[model samples]
Target: MTVAVTGIGVACGLGHGKTAFRKGLYEAPDIFSCLTREGRGPAEGEPPFIGVEMPEPSEVLAPRLARTASFSGRVALSVLQEAWQDGGLDDIDPERIGLVVGGSNLMSREQALAARDYSARLAYVPPRHAHMFLDTDICGLCASTFKIRGFAYSLGAASASGAVALIQAREAIRSGRVDVCIALGALQDLSAYDLHAMRSLGAMGSMRFSEQPGQACRPMDAARDGFIYGEACAALVLCRQDLAAAGKTYGRIAGVGLAVDGARGPEPNSAGQVRAAMTALVEAGLSASDIDYVNGHATGTPAGDDAECETYRTLGLEEARINATKSILGHGLSAAGAIETAAVFIQMKEGLLHPTRNLEKPLDSRFNWVRSEPAVHDIRRALKLSFGFGGMDAALVLEAPDSGGHTS
Candidate 1:
């Protein structure tokens, strides 16, 4: 029951598709731009927050779907298109394909805009608003466009929604419910109110580097403040290893772990993170010494980064080379997990690990940190971590496609 990643597609500030994403990831990591009032940035009267916004994808939806679809839904469709074609899923039976969309309240910004625009003309609000407000709208749009009929649904686990969706999609295939599944990290599309709330809660970065947007997202750095918002949507196509086409597989999901603290809040729990990491290791039949690299869940926050560092130390994984993808891509909130997973696979294939941008000073110097520039390394096994608000933590162990082994 080995679940292999057959295809991946991404739309982020870096660019669209794997080629652009790969080039930007290594060569031009500092692409953060000022958040525009009209774009995916802060609205008027809100504190200035800098972040990365995705370039428009080449794929455009039909005029009919475009009129009613939310921005998040439209972006997701474009991303999914790449994965679908890459996976060669066009030949697969539509009834055997399933989809799992991560993140809830994905259309918050769209809904907020609609509310403000139609406040005085409530009666003239578009009828599509009825379905557009629901997070499942993304699942529906993707399913219809891609012809996935086995099953499709949306799941929310705070910021870990993407990783959790990946786990669920893996399970769907392992359980024989579907021959292939798509795990999509839907764009958060945070509204002005959402940004204000996150900043008020001290979970988001301040305006310290508002003028220097590139330095705003400093994950795992001593000078880091908080996570910067980014606009990104990524999709991964998972299927049974036997179903994967020759030379098309990216890697195999050797193991997965999910843990939740009993309490609810934004704070990180070292114990829960350790539990998740250890569980994933045990599931993968791997020990601390076997892990070569770690895709850390460092969100440029004080509490979050420290907790993750302690978790690695406690797990005796200090020797693993680790880097923060958020430093280069900014935090995609719900989309972080999938994008980072894709990054890990790309690095594994390319034999080079992308650098942690803005990491001038290491938060903790004990661990092996890939700082400032890309490093040449042949990664055989890599661990990816994702933690969300409300005590959600997830870990995944990915094995190189050429790695010979199978997990039950």
Candidate 2:
């Protein structure tokens, strides 16, 4: 009961839709223009930083929804519309479709603000309906948007949420929970409070790249500074085999493997992540040689980069052409997996894979990290790896659609 992906929709700092995102991947690194508050940015002497910034939700979405939830809902609807147009669902009932969304932070930002205002002596919080913030509940937000009445649930696994959604969607459809399932993955920008808290703890990256907005996120390069934070919402529509027979199948989800590093704190076990990759490869009936490209989860952090490099070495997959997209789109937290998945799908369709940017020196000699140009390959199969905080790891095996014909 393998689930096949028929359509995909993504919104990120790069842009919306396939064309916009891909264009951002090839462009030179530039600083991102951030306007959370008017006239409030870097105080002179900030490092070059570019982010995949989305437009204000009030302009792009309905007025009633929260920013984060609206973005995720829009992505789901876009994918569903594309799936319907991809030549399927003519016979399927719209009521039977389902949704499983992954969200890490949910409405914590809004909730925490309200709680703080209530507790503060000088609390000046405006008279606003705090209940609008209630949909900050992950399940409530997603289910309401997609009208997924058959089945709906939310997953929270840090950056691994997207991969988790893929796994859950595959199983639910296989188990007869529903005929169609659209997996949504999303993350939002840090609330002002979150930023201040992270800065106090010395966890936030300094805005040192103010001179250059685009080149701020440099992964695998020797001059890499730190992770560039980003926000995004992405979704992939999947259906059972019979339903897909009526529609065009973009690709098939052959197998998925999840592993835990068991490493304490921020450090992840590189070896464990690699093991998960190998398991997915095996489960998909593929060999290391069969992998056309590796969509890496390198966040430009010192420890994360080191662990990922070590894993590549341990897996003996040094020959594989690797590309770290975080360098282009910034790290979208929970949405990173889904955004990268969408990027990989586009690369497969376009027959090209973009390289990591701003790399003057190679971090690992064994693996080729393309920085100058997109890698051209007959990508029949792709391996996407995501390793997140708390030692969570996930690997997915995606394959091109089967050719319509008899196999001797």
Candidate 3:
């Protein structure tokens, strides 16, 4: 029972499509400005900066859909189509294909709007507003849009959502429930309300890096204050190794591990996170030395950076080269895993590593974090780590196509 990744797609605040997102990854923008506050509110100057203003539905999708829903729909449909072609699914059974998605704010802006307007007296705003509350049900929305009649679930572990979704999708394929599993990760549009709430939690920031909107996301740098909250949608097509054997594979989803630390609100347990990474390595039947690079879930938080550094030292991966994707694409929350995974696929394909922005100072003494420029390294095996609220930690190992191994 092995699983291999055959197709990948990503859309984020960096741009509308995978190519755009990839370009944004390697280039550091001078600034990352905050978008409209459509969902919850963040304080005036908080750490979780918002990205991607409400894009017109027509730009990313057809008419008659909300912006958030449209982004999800567009990415899912595009990935499904691309994967079908990439995997050569002409002879495959549509029924044998399943969909699994992870989302933090399903239709957060919509839900917030509906909740705000749909009081006892103002219950008749419009059907659109009413639909927002329903949009929070990510599972139903994803299934309906994709016409997937097989196994489907919407997992919400806050920031860990994407990696967890991939883990679950791999399990489903390994269990023989389906021949193909698609894991989609997306987030809702942000609003001032969301910004204010984040500010209330002291999570927002006044990180006015520069006039350039792209340069603001600085990961692992000494001046890194907080994260720029961005919205994105990404999808991955996972199939059995036997299927991959019949054709070509972008990479292999080698192993997965998850753990819980019970840390404070919206923060991860560093110890638990380390254990998860170790478990993933062990499950893959490999050692820490097998991993060449790490896509860190460093959200520019004080506790998170220190915790991750401690975990790296504990796992004896202090010398492992690490970079933070959040600094590039903003914190896409649930979509971060899928987006980062796509980036991993790119690196595996191109044989080049994107450097972590910032990182003038080491958060910890042991780990070798990347700086402003890309690093040239031999990346045969890569680790993707994600931490969410309630101390939820997830780790996934990806092997380049020639690695001769797969994940399940």
Candidate 4:
């Protein structure tokens, strides 16, 4: 059972919707800024929060739902609505459509703020906190707003949550469980505690380029410190290939792979990455040489980037034009995978690859790296890789809509 991506919706620092995102990617790519908003900003004496923050979504929900919906819920509804309408899903039976939201503890910032505000007077705390704290709340909010009756749930795999959700949704469609599915990468609303913890753990970037926020996230660069945080949420509508609307399909989900490293921790394993990539290739009935581009999971972390480079070398994919979407958008945590996947589909359709921002010096000179500036290329097939804490790794093979693949 082949699956086709019929529509995509994105909300990120780059912008909202497809047009704005496309312009931000290829035209004006520099958008990182300091997080200066209340509650989200850094505390006194703390280092500035340097990363991309998404613009407020334009979609306005019903007053009743809006009153209780958290930040993640609002953003998820905005993106999902775009995807649903773009995919022309209204014509399909609501019972045949399912929803899968990615990420866990999505409302950490909301919960933290609520706890702080209500600590002085617990009696005044909003009753909505009971449901808003759970990650599944976003699922319910979106399902109800869109009336998705087939089945809906949330999946959490750290940073790989988005890709994992996408894989699960594909399987649901393949198994004849649903005719269409919406895989959404919910925005991970990190609280100050989460930021402090990551910085303390040495996984988040330091203040080396604090004055120049745009240069803080430099994936695959020798001066890279660690992954920077970004706020983003993206949604993709996938349907059975045969049922995909004509002229609406962006690409085909040819194959998908998910694997876990035996050991636990934040360290990435090249061997596990190799297994995932190889599995995806084999399932796609493709060899290494067939891949024209790779949307690498280069989070700007020193060890993570090196491991991915080695994985590419082992897979004989050095010739594939590769770039790190994180360099431009920063790391969206659980939202990274879906956001980057949307980038791949956009580049494939546009026949152009966006540049890796701030990649002044390449870590590995042997590989083909799109550095500094966007490049014009016709990508027929591409591979997207994502790795998370707890040794989770995921890979997906996407074919252009006109590639004469199963979707065609």
Candidate 5:
């Protein structure tokens, strides 16, 4: 059972498109300024909420369709279309394609408008609000628009949603289900709703990085504050190596594992993380030492970063060079894992890994953390880790396409 990642589409604080995102990886993070908060914006003089810029849907989609779609709808459509073309999916069987979108588009302005307006006469809810009212809307829209009449659904498990979606797609393809599956993820579109909501919940960063925006997301750094919510939408086209033999493959999704940390709140659990990692190793028919590097789940929060460091030490992978990409790209919530996987593809292709900046003091000296600058390295095998709220942990192992085990 072999799977290949034939195409990638990403839009994050780092950049958009595979080429730009790959180039941005060689430089500092670009958490410039958050411009997605329509109407309700940051107060004057406050440290601006940095965000990734996405092309306006109005320029590509018709005005009527663009206006009525939810923010996730716009992002999912844009990225999926890019991935579809990138993977040469249009030339393949339409019925063989499956659609899976992952996101927790909660507290969005569009949804707020739909559920509000308690007037004296009656509740005036626009018909267009129906789309925002349901998560199925995004999945359904992708299916209808693309004429991809296969299985379609949406789900969220905090930040690991994207990886979970990919894992599910891998299983389906391996189980003799769909021939090709397009898994896409989007989270907290350029809006202040999630920022304020995370602030109220005491989960977002409070450190004033106004003077140095690039250093704001200090993952695995001593001065780490919290994770910044960033807008992102990414899609990956997955198919069996046999089906995509002639196509370009970034890497192969060799193994996958998922677990629950069983934490009811904002707490860290190393057991779940280690379990997921071990399961992935077992599935890949590899061991701890088989991995050349790790793409850590470090999201800059003090507790999360500390817990991940402990997990790495427990798994005996402390010496394996680990890269924390949130230092370069702000957290994309559900889209984090997918976007980070894209980062891994670029790093693998280029034979180097980006360093974690802003680490004046290391959280754990034992862990071989890629610090402060790029490092020349040959990555034949890599593992990506993503842990989210409610103790959800997802892990994936990828091997170079030229690995002896894969024929693609």
Candidate 6:
């Protein structure tokens, strides 16, 4: 079953929508800032760390909900609104639509802190309770706002949430469960408690301890210490060609594969990632030679980048033009893979591939890395990959619409 991605929307550290995100991908913007601790931020006296902040939404939601809305909810609403318009979902019946949302922990620090400090007494009033307490309430909120009443699901596969959500959404559409589906991932919590926990886990780059905000993340480079923590949200509308007869399409999702290392650790696993890639290739009915470019799951960490690189090498895709978008936009957690797939569209449409930034000394690899500046290449079929903390690995094959739509 083939699924076509008809529309794409993004709100991340790079900026909002396709234009800004594409510009950041190619030009490599110097976009990083310290986590704000004051209004609308985490707690006070928290350790300061540099991260990428998404720009304010181009169009704000209703003031009634905005006043008390969680950051992740706002981001999700904004991106989904853009995607709805982009996909022309108005043409389809509301009852025929479904949504699959991908996210990590998204809770308001103030609300959680209040509940923890003041007991369950502060749990509910009306809207506040709906946003956090209900597992599917967020999905329902988006459904109600979009008038999509078919079915809704929420999933968390850590950093691979975006990719896993897409895989599931595609299958849902293929199974004839819905005529249209929305697959998205977002993260917007800046709670000091969360940041402190992440940093203490040693998941962040050493540059956070210094003043090198511009040089914080160095994916696939020898000097890479760790990944920079950040937040973002990205969404896509999926449907079959018959449903979107005249709609615009970013690309056709040819195949997708998901796997786990079956081990408990944060280290990236080349074996698991390799299995996912090979499975995607088999499902797409294409060999390694059919892939023109690769968007890896590398997030500047030593073990993660090395494992991803080795995975590609083992899969016989080393010669494919490779890119590490985190080098430009930083890792956006759940939104990482979706936003990176959006970059694949720009690269294929414009025949240009973005390079990894700040790669002063690249690690030893046989793969052809696009470094320093944008490289012109005819990227027809690309592979976008993602890896999560729990050893979850995902890979998706995407091909240009004009690439014959041949899968088998």
Lowest summed lDDT across 10 adjacent residues in model 4 is found at 34-43
lDDT of each: 0.89, 0.68, 0.71, 0.90, 0.77, 0.79
- TM-score of every model versus the real structure: 0.97, 0.84, 0.87, 0.98, 0.92, 0.92
Q: Count clashes in each candidate, considering only residues at least 3 apart in sequence or on different chains.
A: 0, 18, 35, 0, 0, 0
lDDT for each residue of candidate 5 in 375-394, tens digit (9 for 90 to 100): 99888889999988888999
- Model 3 misplacement above 4 A: 37-91, 115-132, 135-138, 145-147, 207-216, 245-247, 406-408
Q: Candidate 6, clashing residue pairs?
A: none
State the lDDT of candidate 1 residue by residue for 215-283, as single tens digits: 889888899889998888999999999989888889999989999987588999999998888888889
Candidate numbers, best TM-score first, in rank order: 4, 1, 6, 5, 3, 2
In model 6, where do residues sit more than 4 Å from their true spots?
A: 37-47, 108-127, 133-135, 188-190
Worst 10 residues of 1 by lDDT: 37-46
Give residue 322's lDDT in candidate 3 (0 to 100). 84
lDDT of 3 by residue, 226-322 (tens): 6667777778889988876454787888888999887768664777987899889998988987787888888876667767777777777766778
Candidate 1: clashing pairs of residues: none
Q: Over the stretch 1-408, how does candidate 6's per-residue lDDT look in tens digits?
A: 567888888888878888788878888988877766343344476546777877777545578757655667777888898889989888798888989988656554555555566575554555565455443555866876787877998998888888888898898888889988999886646466656666677777764435768888888888888888666888999997667766377779898899999857577889999899989888888888899899888898888888877887788886799888888888888788777787788788889999789887778656788989899998888889999988899999999878875644
Window of ten residues with lowest summed lDDT in model 6: 37-46
